[model samples]
Every structure is written in structure tokens, then in C-alpha cells.
Target: MHDRTPHAAAAARYPHQSHASGPLVDVSSPEGGPGQHGNTYVQGFGNLADPLAIDGFLRIQEGRVNQFLQVSDRRAEAQRSALQQAADRLSNIANNIGAILKLEHEAIKKQLQEANAKVDEAVKARDELRRLADGVNWTGSAKVSDQEIRSKWKQLEYNIRSLASVLAKCQTKVPSDKLTRTRLDEVSTAWRKLLVVDDYKNFLIGAYI
Candidate 1:
């Protein structure tokens, strides 16, 4: 379509992502041309003219049908644009989600490292307290906080799985919205003509089907 925006760079990079390509013949009546009840007609279809004159007359006739082609191209291009927009929108959203998940994953890893350090510190302190009690008859409980260390370990485990699940989900969502056609047997009549149907099947409908 002349007035429509050209496909964006990102969309252009994925031309094969479009489910359909090319405009179809519309065969519908023109807006203000001879097809308006045939009141207006091509200039010289019946005239016995020279070759150049016949070509000139054919150009005039072609003008009448050009409207249908233009309108159909515009409509088809609009449909393509809508699908591209959907894919772009979904990808952008998923990318943003992935960025967030990455940050959270880093935070979770840091937390796990800190939790492991705390566990090691607590184990050393408790061992030292037991050694001192055995040497000097001191019987006080160890001061290292076991509950606090376990809580941190539990939180670290939870965050590890949560971050992994988030990344997996983002990966799954980002690539599924692209336009991909597996068949064309049920496409519209005008589109079928462009596809050149043969024996109740359009060759474009994929042989695997």
C-alpha cells in the first residue's frame, strides 16, 4: 500500500514470518470507474485499431481494474502489519520480562553465596563452642543461629528454582507469536486464484498435509 509505512527493520528481517505474502485479485467493482454500473466504459475496445492504438486502449481498460488491485494490496498489507505488530509487541514484553528475571537471578545467586558463607561460619562457631566446652567443662549451648542459617538456605533454594522457572517461561513466550502458516486450503476464493489451485488442492497448501 502506497500510504502504509514500510515494514520496520526488525519486521523486514523476518520476511518468512508472514503467514501470507502478496495481494490477491479482488475483481470487485471500482469506486468511480466503468464498473459503476458500466455507465463509464473503456474508450475503444471494439475499434479496429493498429497495434499501438490497441495497446493504448488496453492501458485504459487496465486502469479500471487497477483500483481493485490497489485496494486488495492495501487490505493485505494491513493484515500483515497487524500480525507484525502483535509479534513485536509480544517480543518486547518478553524481553523486558527476561531482563527482570536476569536481575533477579543475579540477586538470588548472591543471596545463595551469602547463605552458604553463613552456614560455614555457623558450623565453625558451633564446632569451636563444643571444643571449648569439652576442654574447660563449660556447658553453654552454641551461640551460632541455626534457624537463621536454615532460613537463608531455604530462601536461596526457593529463589534458585523461581529464577529458573521465570527464565524458562520467558523463553517460551517470546517466540510463539510469530505468523506461520501450515496450510492454505481454506483461504478465500480470490487468494486461492493467486495460489493457482489444482484438483481441489492449492500447491501452496504444503505437500505434507
Candidate 2:
């Protein structure tokens, strides 16, 4: 209980210093930063609030993909149409060729038929000529007598009439096959020679008489 004025004055002046204290926590501790295990941190505060921007981006990407698909489909359709047109053109060409071949075949057949008919008619005419020539029997001798000369002349005249009549029938009929002009000229020359020989023989007989 020995109090003094100096001690009382010291206690009032050092009141805050005597009662205040510091914590015992460590100061040099490792924190979650550059050298720590959790090196990075993320936040949803700026971009997550804007829904319109995200939807617009998605719509743009979808539109680009759909446009590409549409272009591919159009190209494929154009190719198919071109191929179909080519096929149809080929079919038409084939059909036209077949029709032309058929017509050509028919024309050739008709020509052959006409040629055969001509051959048959020519054969019949030749047979008739052969029959006529075979039936005639000239019995006159090669002597200068009035009766023999008259008989030979009459027989020659009859043979000439028969040859003329056969040739007249051939002129009226139409032959389907092609005829050689040279062959007709040769036949005419042969007929003329026969007539000249008969005339000479008759003249000789008349002179002798």
C-alpha cells in the first residue's frame, strides 16, 4: 500500500500499451497462387449473363452447315438429271436405228421377190420358144427344084412368124431384173443373120430354076 505520485502517473500513461496483444499466426505460409497446386481460377460473372450472344453464335454455325448440305444436294440432283437425259437420247437413237434397219430389210426382200418373178417368166418364155422350134421338121432337100424351093420358103416364113410372135410377147411383159443392153443388141444381130441366110438360100434356088 506504498503508493506514490510517480507510479500513479506511469500507470495512466501506459494503459493501452500494457493491455494490447498480437496474434501467434505464422506469417511465411504457402498460399494458392503461382507456386501453389491451384495455379488457375475461373469466374462466370462476365460471359454467363449474356444468353443472346451464345444463341446467335450457335445459329450461325448451324446455318453454315445446312447451307453446305443444300449445295451438295443440288449438285447431286443436277448430275442425276444429266445422266437421265443422256440415257433417253441414247434410247431414241437406238430405236431410230432399228426402224431404219427394218425398212431396209423390207426393201431388199421386195427387190428379191421381183427378181425371182422375172426369172420365172423368162424361163417360161424360153420353154415356149424351145417347144415351137422342136416341133418344126423342115423336109426340103438342098436341090434347085420348084416344089422343094417353094416348100422350104414356106417353112422358113412360118418359123419367122413364130419367132416374131414370141419376141412380141416379151416386149409387152415387164422384167423386174436389170437387163444388159449389149445382150439385146447381140440377139438382134443373130436374128438379122438368120434372115439373111434364108434370103440367100431362096435367091440361089430361084436362080438355078
Candidate 3:
């Protein structure tokens, strides 16, 4: 007959029984209570009656959990390090870009200054050419002597050559400039006219001599 004691009933009624702990004991039968299998006595609630077995299982679970936590921590640390390295590289790239932009700005400023100087020089050359052209004494009074006319003709020839030279220089400096090209064409036309006038004057002087 099975013991109907409260202690035996409580032990039987305990939860967490499993055949995996060891072979299950048929505690419900009077002939099968507290049966031993090898060195283990697996009772109610699996191996709960054996404190050492329960402790060993808990320790194994604790070790597995700790190992998982360690692996996770290492992975997290590696991720953090990678992120920091990427941030550092980006910062370096940004700094390099800023430096490059600064250098480009300085170079552009220098180029602009050089361009302005060239423009000023070209303008001065154009003004000087205009002044020289205006100073030429092309037509003299009828009272002027032939010798005075010859001297004026010589001076006019020199002045025209100077104008051509100045115009050539201006053209070289601003080859793409439409205004400089137009001025050069005008100067070339005037020089051709002067050549014809020079020939006419020499003929008149030769006849008079």
C-alpha cells in the first residue's frame, strides 16, 4: 500500500518532473517508491531532491550565459572601435578638403590680381598710343617752307612707326580682346595711307629740288 503521509504526497505533487534526469520512478505504485538507478536517485521535480545535481546544472547554465555575454561584449567593442576609426578617417578627409579649398581660393586670388595688372598695363598702352597719334603734325600751313615740310614729313613717319609698334604690343597682350583687334586694324589702315602720302611727298620734294 502506498504511504498516504503528507510528506510523501507533497514530494510526489512537486512540479518539474522529467524522464531526462534519469529513469523516472513510479512513485504512484507502492512497489516502485524511491527506486535507485546507478548512482542517481531521481525523485519528484526531476533531480530537485539531489542538491549537487541541481547545483551542477545551474553552474553549467551560468557558464554558458557568461560565455555568450563575453562574446557579445567583444563584438560590441569591435563595432565601437570600427565606428571610431571611420569617424577619424572622415574627419581627416574633411580637413584635407578644407585645406585644398583654401589653397584654391588663394591661387584664384593671385590669378585675379595678375589679370587686373595686365588689364591696367593694356589700358595704359592704349592711352599712350592715342596721345602719340594726336601729337603728330600731319598737315602744315601753306606758308611753311619746303625744308620745314620735309622735316615734318620725317617726324610724321617716325610717329606712325611708333604707333604701329605700340598697337602691336597691345595686340600681343590681349589677343582675344575684340577692342584691341579693332584698334590694330585701324592702325594698319592708317599706316598704309601714310605710306602713300610719303611716296607723294618725296616725288614733290624731288621735283622741287
Candidate 4:
């Protein structure tokens, strides 16, 4: 150990402080501190443990500790800000999804009401046609010609068949193999062949099973 009485005044210059008190100022640096400057050692327990030397070493260590804490605090604050931003983004996304769902629900309800109105119109048309047919007595001399009546009835049958075909297609889900009883109105041969294509198979992935 070496006496530090000479540098006592210099030791008191730093801002950091330490409350440690002991009989040693045993620094780990070599005789010159780990560099090529000069030397610092200890004598017996008295001069080595002088309050000045002890206080100086403690102040230097305190400065290092304070610096590390400052850096750590800055990093912690940055991480907290990042987490808050992520949470806000997720909340906005959730609200947008809810808005979209509400719009879709309203649209579907409107479509249902229109469909009901169309159904009522179709029933009225059928009733009117039945009354007109009853007025033309086939038992006696018919008011309307047989050929004209046959043509009209055939047209009505064709319309009914077309409607049935459309309904069958709408009711069936994609991946039709899942159904135990397969039933669908026939389409053109060329259109039916396209169902086996890879593109069609890929398109079916998004469809309801």
C-alpha cells in the first residue's frame, strides 16, 4: 500500500459520493493502474485506509454505477412506449372489424326483405294465371286456341325448371363430395368439365364446405 496524502485534494473534486469506510483502498489496477501512467499502492492498514483515498475510490465506482442505471432507465422507457403503440394498433384493428361486420349484417337483412317481396309477387302471378286458365272452358268450345294455351304452359314449365336449377346451385356448398346425396341441376357439358381443373379446385378452398 502507498500513502495517498498528496492526492487527497484531487480526490475531493469528483461529484459522485460513497459512504463506505474501511482500512483499505485496495484497487485492482496494477502499480500504475492498468495503464502506463504511474504507480499507486498501499502501506500498512493506516495510510492505506485514509478517508481521502477510500472516499475517492468509492466516488469513482459510484459514478460508474449511476451511469449504468441511467442507460438502463432509458432503454426501459423506450420498450414501454413500443408496447403501448402495439396495443393501440390492435385496438383500432378490432374496432374496424366490428364496423365491417355491422355493415354486412345490414346488407344481408335488406336482401332478405327484397326476396320476401319477390316471393309475394310470384304467388300473385300464379293465382292470376290459374284464374285465367279456369275461365277458358276446355269441356265446351274453348275461348283460347289449344296451340296458344299449350305454348304458354310450356313457357311456364321452362321458367319453373330454370328457377329450380338456380336454387339447387345456390344451396350446394363447394367440395360437393362431402354431401351424402348429390343433387344439382345440370349445366353445359363444357362448364361441368371445368370443375376438374386445378384452378377450380383452388377456388373451392375459400367456399363453405
Which of the numbered candidates is closest to the native, going by highest lDDT? 3
Candidate 2, residue 115: Cα displacement in angstroms equals 1.0
What are the clash counts of all predictions, listed in order? 0, 0, 0, 6
Q: Candidates' lDDT values, in order?
A: 0.53, 0.54, 0.57, 0.55
TM-score, structure 3 vs. true: 0.41
> Mind giving the per-residue lDDT tens digits that candidate 3 earns over 119-201?
45545654554554565565772344567656555654544444433333221222376765565455453432433454433
Q: What is the lDDT of residue 83 in candidate 2?
A: 100
Q: By TM-score, is 2 or 4 better?
A: 4
TM-score of 4: 0.43
How many Å off is the CA of 20 in candidate 4? 49
Q: State in Å the error of residue 20, model 3.
A: 41
Which wins on TM-score, candidate 1 or candidate 3?
3
List model 2 lDDT by residue over 91-128, tens digit each: 99999999999998887676556545544554555455
Return whichever of 2 and 3 wins on lDDT.
3
- Model 4: pairs clashing at backbone N, Cα or C within 3 Å: 1-41, 1-42, 1-43, 2-41, 2-42, 2-43
Off by over 4 Å in 2: 1-60, 135-209
What overall lDDT, based on C-alpha atoms, would model 4 receive against the true structure?
0.55
Provide the lDDT at 104 for model 1.
88
Evaluate residue 25 in candidate 2 and report its C-alpha lDDT on the 0 to 100 scale.
37
